[model samples]
Target: MPDRAPQPVDRQLPTDEARDLISLVRDIAQHEIAQKAAEEEDAGRFPREVFTLMSRSGLLGLPYDSEYGGGDQPYEVYLQVLEELAAARLTVGLGLSVHTLAAYGLAAYGTKEQQTEHLPAMLGGGLLGAYALSEPASGSDAASLRTKAVRDGDDWVITGTKAWITHGGIADFYTVMARTGAEGPRGITAFLVPGDAEGLSAAAPEKKMGLKGSPTAQIHLDGVRVSDDRRLGEEGQGFAIALSALDSGRLGIAACAVGLAQAALDEAVAYATDRQQFGRPIADFQGLRFMLADMATQIEAGRALYLAAARLRDAGRPFARQAAMAKLFCTDTAMKVTTDAVQVLGGYGYTADFPAERYMREAKVLQIVEGTNQIQRMVIARHVAGPETR
Candidate 1:
C-alpha cells in the first residue's frame, strides 16, 4: 500500500517560526520520507540520504545552540519535529534523538575549546553520532559498566564492549562512557571517540522485531587510545552526564511514541471509515467508535505530557520526575494504541500488507529504550516516596 500523507496535527507551537518549521518537516516527511519508509523498513535498508537531507535542512540540531550551527529551537519545538518525523519513519525520528543524546555530553560538559572544535561539524556537517554506554552485562545498572579507561601519559586507553548501540558501526563519532576511577557512578568518565580509532570494532547488528532499518550492534574497544583533549567532563563524572542526557532523551522518546500512536490511530480511522461491513462503515459501530475516541485521547494526552516535561526542561527547573512520568505514560500509550489499531483492522492488521503490525512492533521498543518503563517507575517513585532502602 502506498504511504499516505500524515493526518494533520493541531500543534500548539510556541512561535510563528516554530509553525513554519513543523510545516517544512511535514512537507519533507510526506514527500521524501513517508513514501519510502515502508519499502526501506521492509528491506532493512538505512535511508542515509534522508538523514543527510535533514542535516542540510537544519533538523538534526534543533535543540542546541545556533552558535555551533544548531537550530537553537527549544526542546518543545525540537520534539514536535521528532513527532512528525517518527510518524513518517521511526528510524529517522529516533536516530536524530540518539544523535542528540550522543552530542549532549560534549555540548553540556565539555570545555569551551572542545565545543568550538566539534559542535559545528556534529550539528551541521552531516556527521552522524552514536552513544555508547550500555554494556552486555550492565543494562539497568549502567554505573556498573566494566568498560575501562586508564590514563597513560597524556592519553586514556579504553577497553570493553558497548552493546545495543544505535548506529554503532556507522557513526562518525561516539560519546562513550568508561570506568576511570573506582567501580561506581563516580568512577565513570565520558569521552568523544573517533569512529576510526584503532582497536575499535563493531559486531554484527542484532536482528530486531522492528525498526530493522536502524542498526543495533555491539562495539568493542580493545585498548583504543584517546587523548585528554577529548574527555567530556572532569574525571569521575560520566554517570551524571549520562543521566542528564537521558532526562532530555526520555522526552525525545516520549514525543516519538506519541507520533507512532498517532500514525496507528490515523491508519485505523482511515481503514474503519473506508472498509464497509453490511453496507455500513465500521466507524458507525459504537464499540469501534469508542475505541477510536480513546486512541485519539491517549495520543493527545501523551503529546501533552511530553510537551509539559519539555517546557519544564526548557525553563531549567527540576523536571526529572516529570520526564520519567512522560516516558512511562507516552510509551505505554503507544503500545496500547498500536495494538488497538491492529484490533480495529482485524485480520488485515496482522499482515505485512498493512503497517499496523510494524507500528506495534516498533512501539514495543519505546518502552524498553532510553529507560525501561519499569525503570521510569523506579525513578518516579524515588521522587515521590524517596529512594528504596534495603
Candidate 2:
C-alpha cells in the first residue's frame, strides 16, 4: 500500500471496505501499474495494456449500477481505488476518472434505451470515453462555449471546437457540449458523439508538461450529424448536467492529487533514508524530516477532506462546496509535496534518473486541470458568500 497512515476507523466510511479496496488497488499498483509507469511516461506512450487489465478486473466501473456491468460500489470506495491508481501513475488514474465522468452523463440522464444501448460498452471499458466542454474561447467559464449544434430534420449538425479534451483522439465516444438554442448558457446542449462520425476529428495531441502518456487534444466537430437519440437530457439542460458531472469529477481529481502527494512523500522518505550524506542518512536531518512530516500531514488531511466529501455524496447530502474544497486543497498539496520531493533528492531529483522529477512535472497539471485551483477557490468563495451572492 501507499505510505499513507492507517484509515481512521471513525472516518466517514466503512473501514473494512476501504481497506479491501486499498488492498485490491495496491495489488494492481505494485504488481501491475507501477512497473511500466516510468517507462511509458518517458516514451510518451499510453498504457493501453494497463487500462485493459483494469477493465478486465472490473475497476473501470467502480461506482455504477450492476445491471449495466458496473461494480455497484459506493463513491467512497471508488475514490480510494482512484487514489491507488494515481499513486502508481497519474495518467491512468486521471484517464479512468475522466472516463467515469463522461459515463455519468449517460448513466444519469440518458433514456432507458440510450443507457441500454451504450452503458454496457461504456461500463465494460470496450469503448473509451472523453468529455468535450472547454473550448478555445471558453474554458473555466464553460457557459460561454460557442460550439453550435443546429437541428436539421431528424439529425443535429454539430460544428465547433472542444479544447483540452482528455482521450480526445483515443476515445471511442465523446460527451460533447454544444450550443443549440439562443446565445448563453440556456442555449447549450450535450451530445454523445461517436469517433467514427463524419466531420469529427481530433487535432494532433498537445505537447503537455506532464500526463503526456494520456492524450490531450483539441476535438473539431465540422458539421458532424447526430440523431436526437444521443442527446443527454433536454436541450437546455447541458450546463446543469455538466456542472453536476463536475461535482463528482472534482472528487476524482482530488483523489488523484492525494495519490500523487502520497507517492512523492513515499519516494522522498525512501530516498532520504537511503542516500547518506556526511557518512549518515539525510533522513536523520531534522530539517529534511520536518519537510517529510509536512508532506505526510498535508496528504493525510487532503485524503480526509476528499473522503468526507465523498461520504457526503454517498449519504445524499449537499457536498459541492466540500468537493471543491478538497479538490483545491489536495491539488495544491500535490504541487507542494512533489516540489519538496525533488528537493529531498537534491541533484538527483532534478534528473530523469529519479521519479521525483516526473512527479514534479505531473503535479503541475493537477493544479491546472479539472477546474484550476483558482476556479476551485471561486467555487468555495461562493459557498461562503451564501445563495444571495451566488
Candidate 3:
C-alpha cells in the first residue's frame, strides 16, 4: 500500500483580511495563472495577458492605500497573494514583487508633493516599475555604483548604466540610484526616471536559466535630463531608502521561495504515490516517505519565518534580521526541495514532461538574486553581533 500524500502545512491567518485575500488569490492561481505557466515558461514568452489580468484585478498594488488607487491591503495579505502567484508562475510573481519594491522609495520616502505627483500612476493598473541599483561594477556593494546624476540649476543630468534591472524596457517608470555628491554610499541619491526619457535604452533581455519570461536587462542612461522635483528623497538618503526597500523585498522573495517549494513538494507527493517500483508504489517505501517528510517540514519552517517577519513589520518593530533569516532559509530550502522533487519523479522528473525540472531551475535563481544567500547570512550575523563586534 502507498503512503498517504503529504498534507499542506497549516496556515496561521494573521487576520480576516489575509484569509479572504488568500482565497481570492488561490482562485486566480488555479483558474487563470496556472493555465499558461508551463507553456509560457517553455516558450520563454512573457505573460503579458496574465499581468494585465492581475493589474485589472487590483492585485498589483495590494500593499498601497486605496486613495492612491491601491488595494490598501496589509503586507501579510500582500505576501500570501504573492505566494499563490509564485506557486503557479515564479517569473510573474517575482517581477510583480520587485516592481512593488521599486515603488517603495516613492511611497515611503518621497515627499508629500512627490507622492502626490507619482503615486497615482504608480499604484494605478497601467504603470509598471523597475529598480535601478545594481551595475556591472556593483552588485552586492551597491554604493560602489558609478552611475552619475549631476545637478545643473533646475535639472539633473543622469549618465550611467543600470544592470540587472527586472522590468527593463517594459517598465513605465524606474527608481534609479545614482551618485550626486562624493564616492561613498551617502553621496548617492534616488530619482524617478520615466521609461521614455531621451537617451535611455535597454539592452537585450538576459538569457537566464530560469525566470526567463521575466525580462532582465541593463539600462543605459546617457545625458538624460530630469527636473530636481523627480528626486525621491533628500540628497544622501538614497542608500537608506534602497536598503529599507530591500528589507521588505526580501520578505517577498521568502514568500515566493515557500510557494515554489510547496509546488515542488505537491508534485513529488502526487508522483510518489502513483509511481510503481518493485511491485509497490514508491511512496510505500520508508526512504521516499522520509524525504517527503523532510521537505514538508522545511517548508513549514520557511513559511513561519517569513510570517514572523511580516508580523514584526506590521507591528512597527525592527525585522531586518528576521527578514534576512527568512530570505536565506526559504530560498536555500527551495533549492533543496525542488532537487529532491526531481529525484522523486525519477526519470520523468528530469524531463519537461513534469514541472519539477523547471521548478528546480527557478529555485536556484532565488538563492542568488535579491541579495545572495551569502549576503543574507552576513546581514543576519552583523545584526546578531553588533556593528562594533563585526
TM-scores for candidates 1 onward, in order: 0.99, 0.95, 0.96
RMSD of each: 0.7, 2.9, 3.0
Clashing pairs in 1: none
TM-score, structure 3 vs. true: 0.96
Which candidate's TM-score is highest? 1
Per-residue error (Å), model 2, residue 26: 1.9
Ranking by lDDT: 1, 2, 3
Model 3, poorest ten-residue lDDT window?
1-10
Each model's lDDT comes to 0.94, 0.88, 0.87
| Alpha-carbon deviation at 275 in model 3, angstroms | 1.0
Q: Where does candidate 2 stray beyond 4 Å?
A: 1-20, 387-390
- Residue-level lDDT tens digits of model 1 in 152-253: 999999999999999989999999999999988999999999999999999999999999999999999999999999999999999999999999999999
Question: 2 or 3, which is superior by lDDT?
Answer: 2
| Candidate 3 per-residue C-alpha lDDT over 237-267 given as tens digits, one digit per residue, 9 for 90 to 100 | 9999899999999999999999899889999
Clashing residue pairs in candidate 3 (N, C-alpha, C atoms within 3 angstroms): none
**Can you tell me which runs of candidate 1 are displaced by over 4 Å?**
none
Model 2, 250-344: lDDT tens per residue?
99999999988888888888889999999999999999999999998999899999999998999999999999999999999999999999999
